[model samples]
Target: MDATTLALLIGAGLVGGACNAVAGGGTFFTFPALLAAGVPPVAANATSAISIWPGHATSLFGYREELRRHAGRLKSAAPAFVLGSLIGAWLLSVTGNGLFRQLIPWLLLAATVLFAIGPRLRSWIAPTGSGTLPKPVIFLIDLLVAIYGGYFGAGLGILLMAVLTLIGLSDVNEANAVKNALATIVSSLAVAVFIVTGIIAWGPGAAVLAGAVAGGYLGARFARWINPRILRAIIIAVGLGLSWIYF
Candidate 1:
């Protein structure tokens, strides 16, 4: 890769990692950067997937305390995520990306809308009470969400948070912690599949991996110091900007 492409990869990774640490959607940034750098669409997606794994790991590690507290819940969700991820990865490897290419813009648009109106949705759902959602319901939700993550993974975090809220996580931080852990598992599994298939481009992936690690660490540290409302606003703004460009 040329110097410019290398720079773009690192810069995209840093920004994407920060966004992921805060709200989750770093793929939006890195994927476009890869595409702009002249990588093919499928290769870019696979490369972006490989690159973000470290950031996901870092973010999950940063939430270790929360993960410890929620071990049982996380365990309950893991099997579903793993199963879904394998299926999704297999599907991607076999089917090619024709369908996903057409679906991406609409998926991004919907994800953006959900994110922008997330607070309102939370308010609307609050009165219904989460006590009614059984464990089976939660598992089902996680399974479906993981399938989506395994397939594309752009806004998986947002989708996870929304599902977790429905199942009774009132604290956004706690929900975020779970989201990160589950996302790590799903993405890791998907990346493994892609790597085995030789679908990943190593050059851009390595650069992004370096930047994402640093950015994830910084973002996690900053998360402890920042107000979540402001963080949410920033995430929404970034998501909107990406949607405008990509959609």
Candidate 2:
């Protein structure tokens, strides 16, 4: 990549990591930066996944207690995470560029809309308890969302939050923790798929990874000091701005 593209990737990675650390829309920045850096659609998506996987991994630290307490549930959710991710990555690999491009605007729009509705959706989906939804239903929902994560993943955290919220799941922090943990699993599985299939653009992905790590670390360190509502507004603006670029 040229200096310009490298800068773009790094800048996007920085902001993307901070965005996710603050709220939940890093892909809104990273994916578009990959595309702007001239990576193909499917490859950009794969590389974007690879770039952010580490941040997801690091996010698990905050919820260690919850993860430990809910070990059994986490174990129960693993199969769906792996299976759904593999299937979604496979679907992405087979997608034609033309079709994928056509879908970009719509996908961005969907993610934006989801982000807009995040607060309300969270309230609506707030879990009542385990008895609220059957295991099978929860599994099915997880599998479907994992599939989507494997494919695109821009608004995945929001989707997971909504689903986990609906099952009358655990506390807010626990739900967020579970979401990051599952994201780590599913994104890792999908990364494996992209690696085996050779769809990833290692160069840009590596650049973004470096920046993402730095950004994630800084964001985590300063999370309490930062205004998430401000970061969220920036993401909303970027999401809207990027939608037009793909068109």
lDDT of all predictions: 0.77, 0.75
Q: Candidate 2: deviation at residue 5, Å?
A: 2.2
lDDT of 1 at 154: 79
TM-score of each: 0.89, 0.81
Measured on C-alpha atoms, candidate 1 has an lDDT of: 0.77
State residue 126's C-alpha deviation in candidate 2, in Å: 9.6
Number of the top-ranking candidate, with lDDT as the measure:
1
lDDT tens digits by residue: candidate 1, 1-247: 8898889899999988877777888888899888888777777887888898788888876788988988988888888899988887767776556776876766666666776665566566555644435667667877877777777867776667666656666566777788788888988999988889888888778988889988876776667666767756665676566567666
Segments in model 2 whose C-alpha atoms lie over 4 Å from true places: 104-131, 221-247
Worst ten in a row by lDDT for model 2: 122-131
In model 1, where do residues sit more than 4 Å from their true spots? 115-128
